[model samples]
Target: MTALTLAAAQTLSIAGDVPANIQRHLTFMRAAAEQGVQLLVFPELSLTGYEPALAAELAIAPEDAVLSPLREMARELRLTAVVGMPVRLAPEVGVLIGALVLGADGSLAVYTKQHLHPGEEAAFIAGQGGEALEWGDDRIALAVCADFSHSSHPRNAAESGANIYAACVLISEGGYAADTALLQAYAAEHRMIVLMANHGGPTGGWTCAGQSAIWDTNGLIAAASGIGEALVIAHREGGRWTGRQVEI
Candidate 1:
């Protein structure tokens, strides 16, 4: 079986400061690369700090120079990065909260959130992307914050033949309890490894709970972070998953 080393990063993003956030991402990337992580995932809107009010203003195209460093890092470190950002749509279509995926071989792709939370509908436009990204023998699906709240999210991922369902979310400290329970159920029900990346600081008035985690297919927590900038690295080998954590 093919083995993959992945990292779920819990970080602090500067609200409305895309450059600063990207800088933090690079810091995390270098650390992950040192540990030979194959894939590193960040929290939702990590480039813009999940500020809906400023999403449109901060939205950027996939080719924007602001992400050039990440692309370079991906290629240099031979690591894939699933980074969250606000993607600017063409012409007048508005913007969507999205994930910009950078491949180890200089590939770039965008996956926007298919579902929006109630309050988000007014500020960010929903998008159409819920496909899995293939890495060797693994098919990994991506989810934004609210996508997990919808039943069809994980269902669609499993239907797509994904073995890993990863989410980039901004769960408030008080909301982590419920969200964690739901993710665990998804892992057990779908029989796929579950990975989550959460912010370590406040965003848009909510105190993000930085418990980034990985769960085995059986719904057992394999690795979990604490309430700060941290990294959870999980290795999948021979159909079993085990993990370790590093606080940064």
Candidate 2:
């Protein structure tokens, strides 16, 4: 089998500014591509700074043209990128926290958050999560912030043959320790490589604990970043894994 390279894109978002965030995302994508990354995951609500209060107004369809630039860039770089945004399936369906996957082939897939954090119900509704991404011999499951908190979520992913669990989150300083412990446990228990993409700075009134990281199946840290914009990468080859951190 060929080598697989994955990365977590930790970034700081400008509240309610999709254009600016898109530019930053492009920068991250370019950097990841330069490093030969195959799959890149961004932090939760990365395009809009986790601004629930403005989600209703900011919600867009999965096929919205606003994301064309990102899709084009992903295709050009031949790198799959999972980006966070507010999604509205229809006028009647409530807004959802979505992880939209822009495939290297120029295809798009949507994964909504199946679970909501406390107080999130005021602006978003739970959704049926999307299918796992199939890449050659690997299956990758997607999670958004609170979704990974539910033990059933990761368990089901593993049960379904997913080998990698990628979570996009806006974790604050207060919740960092407990959250990371849970992720590491999930990695060890499920024997699935775990990747976490966290905000690089403050967002939605929370002081984000950056330190985005990746762990091997044994729950050992492969790579991790500090409190800033960076790309935490994990590369697998010859049945072994190695990692590195790149500040951007």
Candidate 3:
């Protein structure tokens, strides 16, 4: 693949507040575009603040008109973007916490969390398969929270020929250390670039860690954020990857 620039947005989300959060996403998208970031990923349930109680009422379809602006932005900036939201799975079935991928060429797809956390099954349904995105020669596999905790997730991506695995999650401070180790191991064992996007503030009564990060193929942290609004950028050039962070 051609050289790639990646970013993970660590931003705040208001519970069950789609309009307000959409504005925040737009703001981040604009800044990322200015920074020439080709791929931008946001934290899980970012559009509605990880509020499972509100998922049923706020769940949107894959082609929901509410996401048109994001699609337009991706196309206009020639940047691929991922927005986390609750998506409708079936008429009476539960919603799925999904990563809504908007591609620069106006392509769209949704990848849902296949592994539900301990308490998530009540609010969301598990998905069957992951989604892949191809840009130049980069093969990217998309995932939501919890999915990265399972070995099968990264293994499936690797078997699918993915060079990068990106996950968006709302990881709390107490669980950060253990979770990060899992991600690092996945990166090393799978021999694929690993990226994570986490929330910057409180959501659903839980305060997130906000340490969005990028792990290189060597199982080392290339870039990581602190406990606030931040962006972790990882660039691949000349077959080498370098990562840095921007905090606000």
Best by TM-score: 2
Q: Write the per-residue lDDT of candidate 3 for residues 109-160, one digit (tens) a residue.
A: 8888888999888888888755689777878998788888888989999998
Residues 125-188 of candidate 1: C-alpha lDDT, one tens digit per residue: 8899845898877899999889889979899899989988889999998999999999998998
lDDT of 2: 0.94
Tell me the deviation in Å of residue 138 in model 3: 1.5
Error of 2 at 202 (Å): 0.1
How should the candidates be ordered by TM-score, best one leading?
2, 1, 3
Better of 1 and 3 by TM-score: 1
Q: After superposition, how far is residue 38 of candidate 3 from its true place, in Å?
A: 0.8
Q: What is the lDDT of residue 155 in candidate 3?
A: 93
Number of the top candidate by lDDT?
A: 2
> In candidate 1, how many clashes are counted?
0
TM-score on alpha carbons, each prediction: 0.96, 0.98, 0.96
Q: After superposition, how far is residue 29 of candidate 1 from its true place, in Å?
A: 0.6
- For candidate 2, the per-residue lDDT at 20 reads 99
Model 2: per-residue Cα lDDT at residue 66: 95
